[model samples]
Target: MTTGRGLRGTAAVVGIGNPRYHKRGTSEDSALALILKAILAACEDAGADPRGIDGFVSYANDLNEGLAVGAALGVREVRWSTMVWGGGGGGVAAAVNAAAAAVATGQAECVAVYRGITEADDGRQSYGKGHFPPLLTAHGIVTPAQICALRTQRMLEADGVPRSAMEALTAVSYLHAQSNPDAAAFGKPLDPEVYADSRWIAEPLRLYDCSRENDGAGALLVVPAERARDFAQPPAYVLSGVQGAGPDWSESLENDAAYTSAGFHPALVNRMWDGAGIKAGEVDVVQVYENFTGPAVASLIDVGLCPPGVAAGEFMTVDNLRAPGGGLPINTSGGNIADGFVHGIGLAVEAVRQIRGSSPNQVAGADVSLLLGGPMAPLVSATIFGSAATR
Candidate 1:
């Protein structure tokens, strides 16, 4: 049942920009400055005047307020300004959804969806201090790695998924990163032996399995679909952007089903594919957020890209996940694991690049690119981007 409605094809991403990426705590610029730079670069990429942008959307409790950013950019006016609630990368796609909705509804003509981060020693790590419920934190499930490990452990032990799949995911991301000059791991390469010997951050999750925190900002411009071709680059149509969590996902660990899953409810996945008027098999590339590799494996299963249980052993090979000739090239810009993790917003920019045929590890003849947001959070999201031919 193809829904074919909603914000599908009503708006398109005309431009994408990332000012620069820096190692965490090494950025000389403030978070706000990085954001402004990214937005201006996006405007330049689209050949759109910064003054024309009237809407802003962001996620992860971004400190840079929209109006403040607008003032910095010297925009004409601030028409719509909003941020998705919650933390982590769960809202990456949701932010894009909000921007597309604004453009589709005429709430704003040109909307910028952006995220910037400059990790301080005191910040981000606070997630382990006060974010979780007392019940879990008391048991030492404070860090995201500890919390997500329980879920991945279940998938590996009870569900019969092999640990090799997770290792392959890590290796493949690093493989793609070697081709992406902007990736933080650009010159670094990871092999099976290196991954196997890496220290364990959590049981079933090695140090290399986790994402690297970086200080950077990424931005993209969205406009009405009809006007997309006027931009400096080819448009990547917003086929669908859906966000929500599965049943009993509130506590992240209380429910057995929810605990083992990636939070992409079956219904939510169905709705996204139906609304896009495309099937999972139609996606030419993918950008699954890798806050950690285990949840990413669960995400692949939940989204119907990889079958449940030990089937992932066969599907998640490094050869099958790499670009150019891979069955489903993923994280073509290296993803959160190998690329700089700018709150997962960089994944969305990579999706747009795949559609525009501008990805550093460009997937040949790619038309549809999918982005799966952070898994196992309070809220999760998925988005699909298509070339103009798909629209």
Candidate 2:
């Protein structure tokens, strides 16, 4: 959507880092401190000097300014900086897209795309209190769970996607989290009985269906693809980074055509796959943003990974979504639902790890990895990462 040769194999993620994750309000470090630590760690991972960082990109209304962070890190210069304008994790992939664009276009040689969250910080606002049209508020659709529930309900009833699909998706993330010590839900295994027994936050959206808020920061260092192999870590090439909303998607609750769909349009999905020169069946793993399980299910269908109708029930089984042997291993880092959510930046980092074959739940021969940002938001994004073989 940015319009050019596209990001396919133009830029590469050389390094990724994150601080120790904590539950909201429990982090000992400030947001700024966490972000700085993450960036420094990324630089170390890449075997690059911190002073080499010349650009910064972030999303979700991040408060850390580029020039300020540059100064803190003693960077040689701040050449470029930008933030994706939107709410929620929808812009996560967009932020990485911007960073890759900067590197590809030579606007800056090394860009660090990062996000930090200190939900307990003073003056922090509840996500549910976001400004909405009176039409939505008057109907008591204030919380995100209530808003997304409507779309999930429609998909189940109208599209005939079984509720078990949502259950399986939720179970998969928790299942993966059990193996990831960094996951907030680590050590807490989820079974179908436990998921079914959980209370509903909104009708059709159970407690396990939602993402957990955590305090942490995550970052990825992007450099030109030619410079990728110089790093210590295996580079994850930027195959494609796509972001946009569907036609007339601004109407939110009133848009009938886009109502039950994830924010990804058919044309957008086509662009991403085309730009990457791959298809849904070619992706070895996916790290779909699990802001809620239902929208994530819709995202999988919208991207052509799963069928649009009752076939999703059979395709989205726990065995089919798990790592190693699953047809489509997803959320290998546990996803936002179980992994620490620093506004979905962690998902991007996990995508890189999958490409590097360093993931705890590594998918064998994972040459192509996909990362889908938050669904059902005003704007959504999806990115594709690949190993050197794909380039």
lDDT by residue (201-254, candidate 1, tens digit) is 998788999998888899999998888888889999889889986667754445
> What do the candidate models score in CA lDDT, each in turn?
0.86, 0.87
TM-score of 2: 0.96
- What TM-score does prediction 1 earn? 0.96
Return the clash pairs for model 2, or none: none
* RMSD (Å) of each candidate, 1 decimal: 1.8, 2.0
Tens digits of per-residue lDDT, candidate 2, 1-391, equal 1236888878999989976688888888888889999999999999999999999998877888888888999999999999887668888999999999998999999999999988766234333335367888898877777878999999999999999898888888888998888888889888778888899899999999988888899999999998888889999998998998777874455665867788888899999998998888999999998888999999999999999889999999989999988999989889988887778888999999999988878999999999999688877998899999998
TM-score for all models, in order of appearance = 0.96, 0.96
Scored by lDDT, model 1 comes in at 0.86
Least lDDT summed over 10 consecutive residues: which range in candidate 2?
122-131
Worst 10 residues of 1 by lDDT: 121-130
